[model samples]
Target: MLGYQVPSPDEAMLIAGGKNKGSTPFRVVTGHGAFVLPFFRKARFLTLSMMESEVDERCVTRQGIALNVRAVIAFKVGTDEASIVAAGQRFLSDQDQMSVLTGRIFAGHLRSIIGSMTVEEIVTERQKLATEVLDGSKEEMARIGLGVDALQIQSIDDGDLGYIAAMSAPHTAAIQQAAQISQSQARQAAAEAEQESQRAQAEYARQTAIVQAQYKAEVDQAQASAGQAGPLAAAKAQREVLAMQTELAQRNAELRQQQLVAEVVKPAEADAEKTRVLAKADAERMRIQAEAAASHNRVALDRMLIDQLPLIVREAAAGLNGANVNILNGASGLSEMAASLVGQGLTIFDSIRGNLNGSSAEDAGEPDAPEPERPQLGDGAHPRPD
Candidate 1:
């Protein structure tokens, strides 16, 4: 088991000291089982995997400036029978030395590439420098049974000379100035925008105040009109009331005029008719008296007395009708009462007729008697003229 080896995928197993090994000089084993019978077999491992190396070298650039360049190179043993055999023959004893040898080889090529380019070109165009180094070292690496995968220039420094920094100063200052200007412009624009916003707010506030004032003025005017409306309406109603009162007064005056016309005119008309009738009666009486002066005076008196008889009876009956006579004994008391009333009425009539006859005889005897001798007649009695 100690002499029996199984190689890994990244390794090649080389064997010597067997009948097939020394006679064949060497045999490669890869990714399979291999038995080395212990004493008769000797085996060594050679790596075929990828490897990387770093090279730091101080080289003179085309500008005669010394620059220290650090670079990394990726390389591997070629996947071919010839390359694997060649690598195995050389590095089978010390597999770790492959990276060491690769570093030295690329160091020389990196120095050569940097020496051909300027310091500016070496610092700015690192890929070009790496490409040149890779191309220059390609043939030398292949002869050593290696293949280059990638080459990168990690850093380039100009030792004590600040040539690279000096070259970038103007551009760096210009960039700083541009950044400062952009920041200043942004601040100025923000200030201007803030000023504009404040101005707009002030304008809006002023306009709002103006509008409020106008609105308040309108409200005050409307309130004043509203305050005046009650009195104005009341005054208008008062005018209407006054007009109605005036109409009532006019109506009352018309009614009063009509009442006065009825009271004064109707009574005056009745008095005028009565006066006319009285005047007519006086004329008829005077005519009768004049005619009676030619006839007998006693006969005229007798005629007048006969005409007054009915009026006297009616007055007596009217007086009796107004009298209140209570009868305790029904029909007999009433009959007695009626007889007494009839007797009194007859006696009154006879006394009136006697007075009238006596006055008529005296008037006939004294036809030229004085007015003081005439007497006034009582109710229901006719006048006796002298």
Candidate 2:
């Protein structure tokens, strides 16, 4: 850069090289190996227009104890050094004049960083301030033949303690939550274990109680049985004794029954036998008397026959030999037959009379009147008593 004052856009100046004897729109001055110049448009293009040209640029803060402003802006016109020199030389030949223009163009960026508080922020973040200033300066100066590609804010010295602390808060909360989760899991596990332990204790207590109750019940049962053992044994023994006595009594009664059968029953059976024989003999005697009475009944039939004899004889004479048997012949025939029947009838009457007085005879012991002898029935002697 050359030390010179920037001129207005309408300013015209002479070229440093003596090759041109007249003034141009931009003035140029020669530097050590390059030329500095000013133009209406950037990149040394001196088109008579008021527009700023496009290019790439960068800026850097000066490294001393001053404002944290951009003190330098590196311009990169698209063309190479020869093109840059040619573009500058076409309108401006004085390099000092071109430097003045370039300085004035970039000066506004330095002014933007001039506030005392701007330095306060710049002091906190100089690199960021420089990066912004460089960008603005490059654009401001592009109208004066300078351009740039990109600008970057390098490392900043701003303090991040609060941000760092804020960033750690979530991690701290997460760690606390993890600890809480771990503690909850442990507590839950412990609770489960306690519940299991309680269940085990309850089970053990229940089993122990059951065993004790069973033992107590068994002991009570055994005691009750022991208390009843003597009385039950004695009662059973008494029942057995009673049964033996009853059996002996039954056996004695059976013996007595057999003896009675032999003595009283045997005699009674003999007497019944004698009574049956006597009753049979009496029945036979009564049957004989009834037959005798029936025979006496034939007396009336004989009388009827006697009266019917003539007709009987006539019937007989017609049927048999005309001659008949002799009546009243010999000792007995029909006449004797009839007479014997009458006499037998009378004897039955006398027998009945004797029967009527039968039991009185033994009471009085009187002699019974004898029956008159019936006339002999065609016999010389009456029939003897049957």
Candidate 3:
């Protein structure tokens, strides 16, 4: 612990006053520990960490425009033994000079590269200019045991000359015009969208009002219908009651008519029919009695006419005797006279019988039988013995 030496991760240990190898005067130890004898060896450290340097230089371009350029270089001591030895021998006495020397080295290369390019090339192609500068400084940096990781052109401007500003004027004007056009288009679109939203809100309000009005109308109609329901039902019930009463009255009228026919009309019709039958029987009995009586009277009348026939003959002879006294052919003439007188008496008897028969039929309330005609006698006479 007293004399043992170790290098930091970013540093290399350089041990002098010792036997070393390969064209070097000191022993370099990195990333490990080493033992050093007291007073026999002097151990020192060289930084191997990243370092930065900035260069600001004025140079005229190929277009003869004087431009001020600022650039940054990132460098470090190499990790190899040879590069470490070289860096330690030159910078170990004063480590702060590494940044100073690196800045001077990159500044020279920056002036040289800027001299070969125009102002436009330097401004627009900053990366190309940095690359060329880095390439041109590579071998020189390696000789001093330094390596560059990157070179960046920080800025390039013509101080107090206005050359760079003049060169960018046209592009700046075009970009400004394009931005103004885009802003105008966005404002117009916002205005149109706001108008459309207002129209949609108005339409929604109109629809809501219409729907509410329709709902109110429907509710009113329902209320009116509900109010009328009871009266309508009562009227219908009254009509039904009236219809039933009318039907009952008609049924009672029909029942009364049927009762009248059964109680009064039926008995009267039967009595009338019985009376008509009895009257017909009585008339038939009377007709039979009349016929019997008429037959008996006709028999009596015939007997009486037969009895009066001789008397009538005598009277006829007597009347003849008084009237004439002449006789011819004597006995035969007298017999002929007697026979004519008897025939006249028989005819007179028949006439009296027919008259009595017509009178009997008239008294019996029957139609009269026709009378028989009487026979007429001749005007010839003969006298007879009285």
Candidate 4:
């Protein structure tokens, strides 16, 4: 086995590719004969063609045909996948001009193709598009027997999507600020309203208290006035009585004059009031008696109607007979025939008074008015009942 030198993956790959890509590898062991064994057991299956070494014609690769170039390539190859391999299998040597040039051409093509692509499309559809690229590139990369040893999608530059992200930052901040401002305003308004509501409640309570106090004051004033009212009124009466006594002493003639009011004037007035009440009562009694007579007369009139009703029926019957309805259809046609009968029967009444007595019939049984009231005797409070 060749000496194993653990290093960075790039360095290890450099050692794997026979220190390819200008990677200066550290030698792990010194020379007993200073020979590289070309330990590429993993590359045993590949078809290798090597040029004859003029110094050593027998120095052919394990699966090699001799070629003009055999110089080792130093490389730390990068790819779209894992570790690198040596030239003719996974890489090309520096002195293998055809292979190196072919590699450069293929690399330029790969770089161009990969560079042309969007990283999202490359990464998101990695398996499909990447495999397609790899497959399509295989023969081209192996044009000079320099097949790709490994591949890696090491660093994908998802180019400059920061513009979209950076642009959204301000918008997000503005939205958040607007939301916070709205929320703060709402909270502030709510708080202010709450405070105002509390103030209103307090004001209402204060006003209510004031009203209650005022009402109590009014009630107390009313009670105090009520308590003083009787004594105040009695004192006023005594004062008036004293004044009246003084006035009576000062005006004896006036006192005598006033006495006439109590005797003559008051008695006359009382007599006049009593007369007026008695007259009113007598008038009312006479009116009631007249109403009673009228009622009796109405009752007599109603009684007379019973006898007259038969006479009316007889006259209507004769008229209906003249119409022949009573003989032909009888009372069944009475409603129609009765009008004719009534017209003819009216002439019978005409022999006595006819419609000329219609007015007198209305006046009959009406009561004569009562005689006017005469004087009587009573107090003036109300008229006496009958």
Candidate 5:
């Protein structure tokens, strides 16, 4: 085991004094096995891993102003055959000096790149400065068997000059003025809006008060009108009651007049009519009775005179026998004389009956003659006999 040698992942084995010796002496070994014998072969470790170096230097800009530039460079031992041989030849014995050599190499490139650029370009475009340094240092780094992974400009300072702040003063002042103007406009608009809101509130309050007053006035007027209604209605009721009583009294008077006509005046008039009719009927009855009596008397007297007529006729016949009166148609002539005498007696009896009836009717207190009919005033007045 003491005679054997091996290399790690970050190491490349450069074997010398063996079968691989004297040609280029570079053997890349990784993870486990670059086997070598201690007496007959030799192995050197060359790191292929990344390494970092800081570049800080004061360099003059294109304007001849000195600027302090700080940057970082990430680099590694190259993986190619030629680059590995070169790095193995150079740093295989002193691996710790790689960072020192890289820093020096990038510092020179940074100075050269800064000398070609202005302070504004260096401050504003840091990446451009880094890129220019990286490109300029590429060939020199490759010659030393190194490859750059990245280069970053960490910071740049002009030492107390305040050149960047002085350059931005005009733009910063313009921005602040714009912000102040926006704030002032916003406050003015808010004040105007608040004033308009207060005016509207006052107008609304005025209109509301007017409306409420009008409503209260109307309510009081209505209350007053309501209070006066009771007496007016009472007076109207009294007038209506008087009018009804007057109309009732008039109606009662008319009823009483109708009752008088029906019960008292009508009956009195009917009774008077009935009395007149009865008196006239009584007169007619009396007249008729008296006339009938006179007719009976005249008939009796006529019958007595008819009995003496026979005697008278007999006496005349005797007288005629003594005188010897000559008569042609003798029996016929006597019969004719007798018939003439009878007719004379009948005529005298009729005249005496008429005269006696008139005298008797007058003596009996009968009316001269009653009218044929009487006008009836009412049916209820007349009570006919059953």
Candidate 6:
């Protein structure tokens, strides 16, 4: 353990006083342990870790503008044996000098690269400038047993010249205008969003109000219907009752009219007809009775006239007897006077019978009978006794 040595993961062990293998002054042992006699061999350690170097230099651009350029380089010692041997031989005594030497080397390259480019290229194309610087210094850094991982240009400016600022003026102005436009657009979009939110809220409120109004209207209508329900029902019932009463009254009136026709009008008509029939029969009977009476009276009157005819004849003859009695042909004259007296008596009898019969016929409402013919006597005819 005393004569054996091990190197750290980020370091290389260099044996300087041993028998070396290649055309190098040290034995580079990496990633393992080795045996070293303490008095016979001299060993040292070289770091293989990552290193950072800063380069800040003033350089002239292709446009004759002097610019201060600052840059950073990330480098490390190489992993191979030749690279280890080279790094150990150079930096074995002082390992911190690696970063210094790397910084100086990159500074020279940075100045040379920046001189070939314009200030615009140096400002805008910083990656290109770094890449070219890295590429130009690649072989030289490798000879010094260093490998570059990356190169970054930190800043580039013209000191008191304002050339970079003057050159970037248009782009800066364009960028500011673009920024202002973006801000205005953002504000406009925010305002539009706020208006849309307000509109949505208003619409929601309006819809809610409409729904509430409809609900209230429906409720009011329902309540009003409920309120009118009893009155409407009562009105309907009253109408039905009135209609029934009216129908009953009409039926009663019709029944009364029928009863009057049966009890009063029909009986009256029957009584009137019976009375008329009785009156008619009495008138017929009275007419027949009068006709019979008139016939009887006429017969009696005829009999009485017959009885008085002889007397009338006698009287006439007597009257004649008392009158002037001169007879013209003696027996014939007497006979003629007696015949005239009988004829006159007969005429008188007929007249009396006709008058009585006419009176009787008039009383009986019958037509008068015809009078009989009177007896006629000749002037000189004798009266017959028969």
Error of 3 at 222 (Å): 3.9
Q: By lDDT, who's the top model here?
A: 6
Q: Per-residue lDDT tens digits of candidate 1, residues 6-107?
A: 988998887877555333367878889798878777888889888999888889988899888888889999877667777887787887788999999999
Clash count in backbone of candidate 1: 0
Worst 10 residues of 2 by lDDT: 48-57
C-alpha lDDT values of all predictions: 0.77, 0.53, 0.85, 0.48, 0.77, 0.87
Which sequence of candidate numbers ranks them by lDDT, best first? 6, 3, 1, 5, 2, 4
TM-score of each: 0.52, 0.27, 0.54, 0.24, 0.49, 0.52
Per-candidate clashes come to 0, 15, 0, 20, 0, 0
- Give candidate 1's whole-model lDDT: 0.77
lDDT (Cα, tens digit) per residue for candidate 5, span 201-288: 9999999999999999999999898889879989999999999999999999999999999999999999999999999999999878
Q: Is 3 or 6 the stronger prediction by TM-score? A: 3
Query: Global CA lDDT of candidate 4, please?
Result: 0.48
Query: For candidate 5, which ten residues in a row score worst on lDDT?
Result: 375-384
Q: Which RMSD values do the candidates have, in order?
A: 23.0, 23.3, 21.4, 33.0, 19.8, 23.7
Please identify which of the two predictions, 2 or 5, would achieve the higher lDDT against the true structure: 5
Error of 2 at 147 (Å): 44
Candidate 2 residue lDDT tens string, 13-130:
2234234333343334223233334452232323222222222223222322232223443444323333344446533445444445554555555444433233235545656665
- Roughly what TM-score does model 4 have, to 2 decimal places? 0.24
Ranking by TM-score: 3, 1, 6, 5, 2, 4
Residue ranges of candidate 1 with Cα displaced over 4 Å: 1-3, 17-25, 207-386
CA displacement after TM-score superposition, residue 204 of candidate 3 (Å): 3.0
**Residue 317, candidate 4: C-alpha displacement in angstroms:** 1.3
Candidate 1: Cα lDDT at 104: 97
